[model samples]
Target chain A: MSTTATLPGGPGRQSGQDILNLVLTVGLLPVLMAIVIIGTSLMSPYFLGWMNVVNILRMASFLAIIACGQAMVIIAGGFDLSVGAVVALASVVTAKAMAAAASAIGGPDILAIVIGIAAGLGSGLAVGLFNGLCVARLKVSGFVVTLGTMSATAGIGLLLTNGIPVYGMPKGFVQAIGRSQILGFPLAIYIALAVVLAMAFVQRRTLFGRYVYAIGGNQEAAVVSGVSIRRHLVGTYVLSGGLAATVGILLTALVGSGQASLGGDAMMLQSIAAAVIGGVSLRGGIGRVEVVAVAALFLTILGNALNLLHIDSRLQPIFLGLIMVLAVALDEFSRRRMSRV
Target chain B: MSDADLAAPAKPAAIDARGSRILQGTGWARQLALPIALVLLLAGFGLADDRVLTTYNLLNIAQQTSYLALFAMAQMVVILTRGFDLSLGPTVSMVSVAAALAMAGIGGADANGIVAVLAAIAAGFALAAACGLFNGVVVSILGVSPLVATLGSMNIAIGVATTISDGRPVQGVPAAFADLFYRGSILGLPIAIVIAILVGGVLAFVLSRTVFGRSLYIIGTNPQAAAVAGIPVKRLLVYAYVLCSALAALGALMMTARTGSGEPNLGGTLSLQSIAAAVVGGTSLAGGRGGVGSAALGALFITILSNGMNLTRIDGYVQMIVLGAIVILGVVLDRLRLDGR
Candidate 1:
């Protein structure tokens, strides 16, 4: 483990090999984003427009938020397939609570909004708790646990709304959070940016983050070194669940209704793709949130650009899939090159 | 003194041997948790609704479970090697489209009747196998993680499926084809059920008795150890993916037959369903410890649950919740069994 200076815990160095891997991992996203920008600009005159760019940014914000959480989970050597379902659950719960609150108060009250948000976010927290306990305590695989939770939560969401969208959210709240722009961009972009920055800091400078990398790098080593694997692993999942819930609420605002199937499975898939394209290893313990943010933008832009070019929306997944495979291949190539050196 | 003393000692030894045999039986019982639950469920549902135990309902379950049984086999094979193929669902969708297009004529809606139907079925399997080959190459040769590699392929397959089918369902298949594969029955058994049983039996034999099967378990248990022991780990893994995809393709064709149309969106639930069935059947997500028979049994169990729910007029959403809970419960039980050992 020490031989690979590319590891986060390795001794500080300006080694050439280390620098190469860093460039491949951290620098790849921006280069790809630039290429996408240039290509899209060439393909469509509207691609370079500020309005279009902002539109892409706003859309990418939701994905970026989810990807940020997913990046942490991946770095901690875990995967969460239930984030999409958590989003739906949060959306329905929040919308339902807020609707009831609005009716009792004869309008949307501040207290009602607070209660609604808490209930929504708490639902997410509960899901995380269950997943964390099962994975960490019962020792179940994260993939299986999350897959089960995803389906179960989605079912709960559907039951809450009976497949109907909950309408009648306060118009002011929707406009303020979902429709209105702040500082030339939607509120969601700012929230996503804040999350990215905070998570990046946590990953770089916090003991919890260090423990996550350690656990992912080598669980036995981490345990031998007195790190609490269960705590960190469970915490990572909880954080991911919270973030997914936030996205769900944001989606509700954007859509002006509480949808039981908001985001669905596509959101989870895109989040994983964005994180991978940003150089997060599915093998775990190596990624940067900043790059993930850019990757999220690139993915969102790629889809938007395809739509602008009049390509069928159904064909969009193919490009995203191609990019994911290529990105992982590049990551693998870099890792191999580093090892050889 | 010699005869009497010797007889007394032998009697105690025989008793000890019987005691140990009972303990071994309990171990087997632990492994049969899912099966036991299935039997209990059947008894309860049958008691509640006499129709559930009727020949027609039982046959319906057999027919319904056939596709999932095939999928579970495919998933079990891959999981046996500690790999996942998330693209299985999309592969089915793509194969469905390919077969439909072939039957609908390459260019126009002109069916060549029997020849075209046979050719279309063959084309579907070939396409599915090709998709599996792609997954294998990416995972084994490129060394990408199975999760990411299969995910990328899934997106690509889904895109291709929707594009080729023009996002619409193709319905030009001859009625005779569907009848033979789906509706036809022999000895009061649906052909689909017969095919599933035959395939399951063959796969179970291969996994238990073949060198290839043993190699897969060895690699899945510990790849480095398997490599050191002279197994061609990479090649076997590739074969596993290919086999999995081929099985998925067969399921896809069955789905097309059952639905009597080629749907671009068919099998959206397949990846999850297959994984659930495999896991429920005691196939460890960690790999190396499951058989084809268990997987088929698991599929039957799931089918029975669904069929029972429908018969009892249980809400679909509630059924989803129950099924999801069952997946988690199965995994938890498996974990407990392992820990006990």
Candidate 2:
């Protein structure tokens, strides 16, 4: 919001310098992405294979879905570290609820799955709303608030499952929908793409999206201009929570079980990395959903490339860390350059 | 959910400013709040188990608390300057692996083994210091946000550690290495405890009696004002991060020695736990308002709660939930103090 607001642009107008700047900054992700893909294909026979592409997209879809919410939260001037934890929590609760509903009420698999998903998403929203209340009402910093929720929510999930993977989800859920493919691609790919497109629509052409950008871009002006900072911030958190739960439930279905440690697998950092790489301003009020999806895709492909190249998987975080730092550093420098101008 | 790296901008106090107040907390801070809570926890746990109050168990708690105390101090130092060091935990993990791998490279434990241990310690400290330096430069010189800078460093350190150890614990260090740093006693106190006390004492003195400490608070409160007063803001921030990382490394090294191995995953929960301790102990996330004393108290409180819960056979997941709740409670308590004022 801040960056684009200062730039000379309207919806159908093109300026040479703006295009150049966009290409250099946000546009660079796709360029790097192409280079990675081509370079990996050259280096490894398996890189461009059909199976690998599907697998990469499936992985990217999960991250992209969660990161969409992350980007929204960032655009609204808040951060939710608990997104990953929400994933795990949702997974656990969904499985638990699905199992309980099936046994207690003797319901059909579809009903059980629906119950599980609702339970999962409901818990996620509860966690998000709770975090929002703490941040908005109690005025705790978002980091600390979400940090606490991350632990507490995840702990609750783990406690419910006793540190074990929850398995009682119906078999058909995994077979028919969870692992199903459509048009030679995994169903997750379609779901992810749909989510990305919908979010892009909401972010670009919706009143709520405008309010979020206004809030993050300038809170003082937002307040003066009649935006309910608290309400909007809480609403953003709810959406983030809901998305994280979606990932959790989807991953649970994919794995055919709910594992409490899913979120601990560095999911939080990766989600944030996706958002940052997509050019979501840390100061808030700046981002593009389509760009974020690309960022997530690039990250998945990069990891796949490393694996295909026989790089030690243990050292993967180094690449992620370097890229994240570089992206952030670039953002800072660009912002400084713009502010100077 | 981790450390300083993910601490989003906006202090709890600065967020809402006014309106919400649960109660008027007494005293300049309700100074007795943390201590009273500590006493209640200790007493409750002691009553739940006869062995809890034993000198042996008390010593055990002290030894464990020492590490957390060290980490809390490290976090406090950075938070004092409006900086976050999520990398502290990873620094510990990376340093542990580096130190262990370095020591493992040397053959048998002989007269030369003493020199080998010193060399291992140096290697660990060097790696930790290097990480700190990188975080400092990125945040201050490059104008990157502290959260992202430290987050990147965290992942990088974790990657290096995993690379060195192949994601497993590195073994085969000399028994004497553990003896000198962790097992050996100074006047019947664990060496780790003694070292923690000495470090805390020195830090307390430095923070209270030095120009650097004063400048840190000044810079944290208002960078512009500090610059106008001729404070070398960037350098001091760098120093704070370096100090934070180094201190965390010391704690990690001690724990690594005690385990007689370098654990690549050693830093997993330390980030959240240390931040929890710091905030609970009364260190302000807003910066410019916390010290070693409060951080130590926070660590002590957390340690006691965990140890007591263990003594009474409480689940680890429950501990995580309660610990996370304490972090939020601490902030709410902080706000209440402000409201009281």
lDDT of 1 by residue, B1-341 (tens): 11111112212475346435534543655756677788999999998888999987887887888889899999999998999889999998999989988887743344436777787888998888788888898999999999999999999999999999998999887776787678788787788888888888788667765778777877877899989989988888889999999998888888898898899989799898999998887777887767776678788888999999999889999988998898999899778866764
Evaluated on the second chain alone, the candidates' TM-scores are 0.89, 0.91
Candidate 2 chain B, poorest ten consecutive residues by summed lDDT: B1-10
Residue pairs in collision within model 2: A1-A285, B5-B147
Model 1 chain B poorest 10 in a row by lDDT: B1-10
Q: Candidate 1 - CAPRI tier?
A: medium
Candidate 1 residue spans exceeding 4 A from truth: A1-27, A106-108, B1-26, B106-112
**Predicted candidate 2: interface RMSD?**
0.8
| C-alpha DockQ of every model | 0.70, 0.70
